[model samples]
Target: MNDETSGKASIRRELLASRALLTSRDVEDAAAALAASALELPELAGARTVAAYVSVGREPGTRALLDTLRARGVRVLLPVLLPDNDLDWAAYAGPEHLAPAGRGLREPDGPRLGPAAVLDADAVLLPGLAVDGRGMRLGRGGGSYDRVLARLAAAGRHPALVVLLYGNEVVARVPEEPHDHPVDAVVTPAGTRRFG
Candidate 1:
């Protein structure tokens, strides 16, 4: 790995280790707060459709926000992980519609809408370990969302890219690569930060 790649790996490990220390209660409280904070963003409030994902493990929870969006008559799209690590989307009906998947993920059990479906979203809630001051996000290095971002760009669709994270996950900087795209905003338990 190059310096940028190794640096990202180190930072990811440290952030994940901190997340592992969170108690179940801590995760729950953060989830509620995250939803509240994220809901207040203009990007979400005005969005007709949102592309999102279900949180697994200690990652900052998105369930509450996803449900609220669906409740608001907003069409919520959840991801289905393809074997190649690219994501396919499906409409999120409710909690009952999510089924267990590999890597401890919970994916929507509805019909696959194919990967390009994300282009129809007005906003996308991304899962990440951390985001930097520059709005660059540090994902799990899976490259799935990277593909999603690329697809959106290729189609000239510029949805509001947002990341839901804990307050501490917003850092001064993160290792960035050429293919890495900056997010429009990040919602933490504390509040939301927007970038240009």
Candidate 2:
């Protein structure tokens, strides 16, 4: 791997390790706080549709946020992992509509709306390990969300790209590559930080 790639890998490992240390109670509290903070963002408050994902393991939780958005009469789209690592989306009906998927992910059990469904969103809540001061995000290296960003760009869809993370996950820098896309903001347990 090149320097940038290796650097991202190292940072990702550190972030994941820190997350692994979080207790279930810690995760729960953070989830609630994150949702509250995220809900305050104008991007979400005015959004008619949001593309989001279900949190698994120790990743910053998004369940509360997703439910609240749905409750507000906003169209919430949840991703379904395709075999090739690209994401297909489905409407979020409720907790009972979720089913287990590969990689310990929970996906909406509704009809697959295809990958391009994300273009309908006014905002997208991304899952990430970290986002730098420059708004560049460090994902799990799966390239799924990368494709989502690319698809949005190709279609001229500029949804508000937001990441849900813990307070500590906002760092000074994140190793970036040419294909990497910067987010519009990050919503952490503490609050939201917007970027250009």
Candidate 3:
């Protein structure tokens, strides 16, 4: 494997290993802080709709950010894994519909919508194992987000792509494959920083 892919592999391993030592609450706290910082960005102001992930594995929580966005009248959409490994979406009207989904991820319930609907979001908060300054993202061996996001980008209808990570998760560079997608920004507990 090339340096980029190797770097991403190392980061993913580190994150997965670290998750064993972290409580759910700890991830939630860090996620809340990171999302708050992202929301503070001027480019993020007044967004009508946002798409967030149901962080599973070592990814951080987006619950706090969802609540805050709802308070501001911003609609939120969460991913639902489709039978074909494509991502479907649904509105997170409130916490009432949320339940634990596969892989220990909690997502909003309701009907599953198409990828086009998710692409309509003003911003998309991505769940990644690690991210590089170039906006390349490393996910949990699934290409769902990468494929969906890449399609959106190719169509020029993509929302701003932001990866949520712990501060330590940021690396000098990440491994890139022809199919990997690049995020627009990375948000950590420290703050939101633009990537590619």
Candidate 4:
């Protein structure tokens, strides 16, 4: 399977390495604190509605930041995996609307909307196996987020794409596909940096 070859195995390996680097309690605390402070960015400060994914596997956790955001009056949106393996966007008022779902990822419990609604978000926190300084995201080979972000970009509604990762998950470069979605920034324990 060429799909399994090109970028998939590399991503899986990176995910493993990232998890190893983050196993320390210090890294976890630092990452969480940085993610929480991202909300104070001038660009994100006034954004009322924001979008984020329920992280799985080796990705850094977002639960702490999500709760902090909600407390600050920011509306949060979560992704629900649809039947075709695509994602449906829905508003998350709180934890009560979520339950265990596809691939063991948590999703919202109620109605879902189209990609257009996702694009309406002020910022999108993308989950990835690895990310490079250039802002390239390596997802789990499903292409769901790549497809969604592409559609949003094509319409000229470019939301701030941010990648959350453990500090060591940052790499020199990641293999890219023609359809891969590029993020606007990468957020790690060290700090936030803009990408091209």
Candidate 5:
């Protein structure tokens, strides 16, 4: 593998291993802290509709944040993984309405909105293994969020791009490619980091 590919693989392995060490109580506390930190962001506060994802396994939990958004009556959109690895969004009804989807993901069981539905969001919460100081995100190498970012650029939409990760995942640098897009901010259990 090339340097870029190998570098990303190394980082992903390290981060996932660290996450695997967390206990159930740690995850629960981190989830609550993450939600509080994210809610304080002005972008999220002013957003009418936001695009977000679910946290599976040991990933930084988004459940608390999603529930808070729904409780506050803000429109929340959750992604449905398309067969092509692209994301199709759907309105979040609640935890009760989520069904077990492929890939250990839970998606909202409601009418499907086309992938372009992301264009309507004022903020987007991304899932990633890590993010660098320059706001360049290191995703799971799934090529999913990369396409989402490219689509947003094509539509001339500049919504607040945010990634939710663990505290240590905010690192010094991350490998980047030509197609990679910089995020505007990140929310971790510790606090929030803003870039640009």
Candidate 6:
């Protein structure tokens, strides 16, 4: 692997370890706080359509935020992981509609929309291990969001890109590769930070 890739792997290892240490209560509280903080962001308020995801395992929970947005009449979309690690989307009806998918992830059971559906979103909530001060994001190495971002760019769409994480995940730096796209904002339990 390249030096930047190696560096990111090392950092991800440490971050994952620390995140795994958080208790279930910690994750639950952070989920509520994250929803409150993110709901206040203008991007979400103004968005008519949002592409989001389900928070499984120890990742910063998105359930509260997802439900809140849906309650407010925003059309929320969730990712359906394709076999190749690219994402196809489906409308999120409610938590009841989610079924356990592969890799311990939860996905909407609604009709599948083509992967290109993300291009129609006004905003996208991404999952990541960390994002640097400059907004460069370190994803989980799945390359799913990478493909999403690339598709958005290819289609000339510039939806507000956001990542929800713990405060410490908003770090000083993360190795940036050519395919890495900078997020427009980062929302943590603490607050939200925006970038160019």
Residue ranges of candidate 2 with Cα displaced over 4 Å: none
Would you list the C-alpha lDDT of every candidate in the order shown?
Answer: 0.95, 0.95, 0.78, 0.75, 0.94, 0.95
lDDT of 2 at 195: 94
| Candidate 2 per-residue lDDT over residues 47-71, each given as its tens digit | 9999999999999999998999999
| Candidate 3 runs further than 4 Å off | 1-7
lDDT of 2: 0.95
Error of 2 at 39 (Å): 0.8
TM-score of each: 0.99, 0.99, 0.88, 0.87, 0.98, 0.99
- Expressed as tens digits, the lDDT of each residue in 1-196 for candidate 4 is 5653566676777577657655557555865766666766655677787888766554677777777778889878888887886778887767777799868888888777776787788888888767887788877777788778877888888778888776666777787767877788877777777877
Q: Name the runs in model 6 displaced over 4 angstroms.
A: none
The candidate, 2 or 3, that scores higher on TM-score is 2
Instruction: Kindly list the per-residue Cα lDDT of model 6 for residues 1-196, writing each as its tens digit.
Output: 9999999999999999999899999999999999999999999999999999999989999998999999999999999999999999999999999999999999999999999999989999999989989999999998999999999999999999999999999899999899999999999999999998
Please say which candidate is ahead in TM-score: 1 or 3.
1
Off by over 4 Å in 5: none
Worst 10 residues of 1 by lDDT: 187-196
C-alpha RMSD (angstroms) for model 2? 0.6
Better-scoring candidate (TM-score), 3 or 5: 5
TM-score of 5: 0.98
Worst 10 residues of 5 by lDDT: 1-10
Better of 3 and 5 by lDDT: 5
